[model samples]
Target: MLMAGCAHFAGRHPLLGYTEKDHPQADTALVVCAEQEQYICGITGVNQVATWEKFNGGKTPWVRVLPGKQVIKLTLSNSHQLNRQQVTIDDVQAGHVYRIDVGFNATLLTASYTDLGKMDAYTIHMPRFPLSPKAITASF
Candidate 1:
């Protein structure tokens, strides 16, 4: 039953990469969510983001964003509970790649990013709490 539900969701939202018809412009930056084994991390939204079909193509997890400041909404799950977070990039530059890593340690959730341009990293720690099943479902 679980597999069937996942298949249904995947059919509705197929992952794709950048293509000529749906590729990012030269003046935009790319942001990707780093997959971790201890937790599940995903990019739920981007700034003024349309559907996930626009930025992600070719089966990639990265999304394109305009230069300057951008806000990315993310969801982190550890099977039992789910948490939502927003990470802001103050100076996103064009033609550069950025990666956001979500980590779970005890009751804390940490989000970090490294700008590929400077290779500098920053981390944001958020308190994690268990949510009721109804609350988790409502997040969708």
Candidate 2:
């Protein structure tokens, strides 16, 4: 997994596999903190049986953050096809480890929560192209 992260961080970020949404080539550059964790949640309904259950099973997935430095360079791959983009990582911390998640317009997904002062998902957006998992390149 670390090797894969290094490859993605050092080598070319892949764009060959993914569900293309709007275009054949769409991507964004992202800078994120890397951390490892396992999350599990269980909920019981009125019947007292475990109705809702989910677990991360002690897995690590890259999560995004606001760049604390001035500008962090990232290589983004197009979502539909093979491509790359150069972006600035704004308001994100440097050398800090965080669970990073790379995806398109993540802010929109949790806008209501953010506005309501709840736990909100951090996100970054690019004008021409947004960040997608297919374009994420990182070193864990």
Report the C-alpha lDDT of model 2 over 56-78, residue by residue, as the tens digit. 21111222222243222222222
- On TM-score, the leading prediction is 1
- Model 1 Cα lDDT, one tens digit per residue, 1-140: 66434323331322222233454355566676654556666666666553243222211245666677888777666767677777899998876667888777778676778786622222222212242211111000
Q: Kindly report the root-mean-square deviation of model 1 from the true structure over all alpha carbons.
A: 11.3
Question: Model 1, stretches more than 4 Å misplaced?
Answer: 1-24, 50-60, 118-140
The pairs that clash in candidate 1 are 16-57, 16-58, 16-59, 17-57, 17-58, 17-59
Tell me the alpha-carbon RMSD of every candidate.
11.3, 18.7
Off by over 4 Å in 2: 1-68, 78-80, 98-140
